[model samples]
Target: MDVVVARIGKAHGLRGEVTVEVRTDAPQERFVVGRSFTTDPAQAGPLRLRSVRDHNGITLLGFEEATDRTAAEALRGTLLVADVEEDEDDENAWYEKDLVGLRVLTVAGEEVGEVAGVDSRPAQDLLVVRLASGREALVPFVEALVPEVDVEGGRVVIDPPAGLLELDEG
Candidate 1:
């Protein structure tokens, strides 16, 4: 399966480097030198990474195909995708790719939302769910809150405590 690792941002300087909006949790592992990625438009890449740098906590990437500012600018808004192999051994952990787009439901089978993304934080990971009412909720990715993740069934069973789901609401 192809998982988006980052999106190309503005051209950083004259030498083909571009700032990237990282989409994955493992940026250090993904943005290595000589790593290649396929692009969303299917034409901007397969781009090979020639350089990777960090400036003020921003990730800057240089592609072999993009040798100048004009070349880098052309890649703006392009998503960098990498092929991922699902780990059969680790049944407990779900990749951010696997979690996104899954149906969110209550234990009673009430449809609540769809998972928009996973927020990897220092304290705990959050399941960013786009609710049926169009508001987004950040459910803590814990066993107490999320009891079941049925990937093949395409649903996640969440048991939110009182007022937990309404925390994001106005």
Candidate 2:
């Protein structure tokens, strides 16, 4: 199985570094120096990582093929794929790739919303849910709130606190 590790953004500097939107949870392990990855468009096979750095909170990557800013620019919007199996061992852990777009329902089987995005925070990750009534809610993706995650079933069970789901009503 293959998963997206990062999506190439605009070229950062003139050092063949391109800003990338990280998609994997283990960036430190996946984007390490000398690590090689395959591109989506098949521009080059095994894009070896030359350097990886953070600039103003954004991840910038330098690949072996892209030796200059112009070269990196050509790779804009390219997706870096990693050939690996999905790991879901931890009880409270869900990969970013799996959490996205999963449905969120109450314990009573009431439809609440669908996961729009996942925000990894220092304290706990949050699930940005797009509610049914066209409202966005930030539900803490904690074990207490979200006890069940059926990735294959494409749904999550959230036991929200009182007023947590009703806060969006104006």
Candidate 3:
């Protein structure tokens, strides 16, 4: 499984260097020279890092084949991905891929819906759950609401406040 790590922004300098918006927690070590990673599966080849340096706060990377500004500019909007070989298990840590398509239930085992998506906002993260009635509920992914998440059983137990889902009922 490959997880997205960065996105190519624009050409940085005269060389075939492009500004990269990193999405991964480990950026410095991941973007080292001679490192090769795929952009997309549909694309033919992987991007081989010729050189990597920080410009201001952003990461600038030069590819192996891309020689000039024109070549680097062509790679803008490419999504850099890294292969997830092993599961890095941490307490209370959940991968976005594992949460998607899992059944959402209450603490007492009342079925709410299936996990649709997880939105990471500035203030708090939201769990978008698709209910049995075909309606979507944006439940806050807080400690009080989401008490238990069983990844192996493919279920998430949420204790939402009264009328939280009812208020948005159509």
lDDT of each: 0.90, 0.84, 0.82
| Candidate 3 Cα misplacement greater than 4 A, ranges | 87-91, 105-113, 117-147, 158-170
Candidate 2 positional error at 140, Å: 3.6
Best by TM-score: 1
Worst 10 residues of 2 by lDDT: 86-95
Candidate 2 vs 3: which has more lDDT? 2
What is the overall TM-score of model 2 with all chains considered together? 0.72
TM-scores of all candidate predictions against the true structure = 0.78, 0.72, 0.63
Candidate 2 lDDT by residue in tens digits, 89-137: 7655566777889988999999998988887554567888899988988
lDDT ranking, high to low: 1, 2, 3
Please, what are the lDDT tens digits per residue for candidate 3 over residues 1-170?
A: 78777778899889899988776556776787888888864372488889988777777889987889998888888888878554576657675788999999998889999999877544577899999999999999888999988889899999999988776775
Candidates ranked, most accurate by TM-score first: 1, 2, 3
**Model 3: pairs clashing at backbone N, Cα or C within 3 Å:** none
- Candidate 1 residue-wise lDDT, 1-170, digit = tens: 78888889999999999999887667888998999999999989899999999999888999999999999999999999998766689777787877889999999999999999987554688999999999999999999999999999999999998887888576
